[model samples]
Target: MWLYAGRRIVLTIPILLGVTIICFALVQIAPGDPIQNLLSPTATAQDAARLRAAYGLDQPLMVQYFIWLGKVCVGNLGMSISDNVPVAGEVLHAFVNTIVIALISVVLAFVVSMIFGVIAAYRTGSLADRLITAVAVFGISVPPFWLGVILVIFFAVDLSWLPATGMGASGSETFSYFRWADFKFAIMPIIALALPPLGIMTRTTRSSIAEILNQDFIQTLRAKGLSEAQVIVHAVVNIMPQAVAMLGLQLGYLIGGSVLVETVFTWPGTGYLLNKAVLTRDIPLLQGTILVLATAFVLINLVVDLAQSLIDPRLKRS
Candidate 1:
């Protein structure tokens, strides 16, 4: 098990390097100069050239990449051109915000989806199953941003039960833990981030469970006089490898979706930070943030792989 985990971690090195190349390339191709962001409207051609030179933007792309890569290797995430502060701190802050929202959202989505999926599977063609499946389909189809807007209008503005946007209190900048006011603010955004993935998981679970129920072992267990509930509980446990694997996939989706959800909700997560970075063209900040998110994605999959192996020891042998 340790060896398998070690192998996965070692493999992430190349993937991380490739991610850096792709992220850097895409950002470079994007229009709008970070230099333009640096200069005032009245700045002259000389000033533009000087600023470019100062920032080494005049250097070949490859050179600039290597320079940034070198700094990244030494624990420096580089400085924000706009604020001239260490990008590491800002990136870390945003990373924390994202983890808080993403973690809760992922777990809640996974558990709820499993329960709903099981209920739907049991009911099969009944009205209850139809309603559950329809809800899941609607969740899968609805764009999270639109859902977020609707939720904000209905729950925050009209009902006044929750705050519309932002992650903190009247004066506090970010949420550290569960505080009633900020937690209330987070509820809507979390629901927004969870729904799409939850919907996908529900559909997948219902299908997987249906398949498991038809298996020979399930029939054998039924023949042994086990109740349907007992057999289903066993089947659910047996089917967990696939469910856990899906968790990794859904987690990736949820993290990516949080970008839009955060924006709509004005949540102070990495997605919101990322939006600001693009507007200001904070290259180093963008680079660092993308790298961190990529690292998280890889790590989440690794953990899921290990979990599968643990759940089904045959996976470890393979």
Candidate 2:
């Protein structure tokens, strides 16, 4: 297990390097000059040149990338052009806000989908299975952003059961999930983020579990006089690695893809930060946010691989 883990860790080094290259390249390819947007309309050519040189924008792409890479290695993400602040600090602050709700959404989806999947798989052609399948299909088909809007209208505007947007009265710093006042603000965003993943995972789990149940080992277990529940436990264990992979993927999506949901609800997360950065063409902020999110996605997959290896030692042999 340790040897497999070491190999996986070593493998991530190149992937991380590639991720950095992609992040840097994507930001460079994006249209518009951030410095032009930053400067006043009446600013002279020398002013623009001086500002560009100051930010190292005047340097060659290769030189700029190396400089940025060096700073990143030491935890400096450079300065945000729009905010005039350290990119690391801004990204870190927003990342914390995003991760909190994202974790909650993924865990909620995992537990609920596990139950739904198992039931649907066990029942196969029954009405219960059909109903669950229908719900899962709806989840998969619906756009989270659209759902977020509907939820905001129904719950926040019409019923007034919850606040439509923002983290809470006090913002992310003072917000507590334990407090109803703050928790209510998260419900809609969580629902929006959770639904798509719940659907995908439910389908994956149902198919995997159903396949496991049909295998000869399951029949052997049943022939040995094992109860239905015990047989199900075995099947669930057999499908866990796949379920965990889906869970990790969903979590990564929630962390990085919540821009629309976050925007709808005005949640101060990395997604919202990304949206703002893009609109303003805040190059440093955009680059930093993308790098952080990409790194997060890669790391999530690494953790998922390690978890799969632990659950099914056969994975290590591969």
lDDT of 2 by residue, 1-318 (tens): 899999999999999989989999999998888889978999999999999899899889999999999999899999998989999999999998899899999999999999999999999999989999998999999999999999999999899998999988878888899999889999999999999988998888899999998899999999999999999999999999998999999999999899999999999899999999999999999999999999999999999999999999788888
Tens-digit per-residue lDDT, 198-225, candidate 1: 8888998899888888889998999999
TM-score, every prediction? 0.93, 0.98
> Which window of 10 residues has the lowest lDDT sum in candidate 1?
168-177
Best by lDDT: 2
Clashing pairs in 1: none
Off by over 4 Å in 1: 170-174
lDDT of prediction 1:
0.84
TM match of model 2 to true structure: 0.98
Q: What global local distance difference test value does model 2 have? A: 0.93
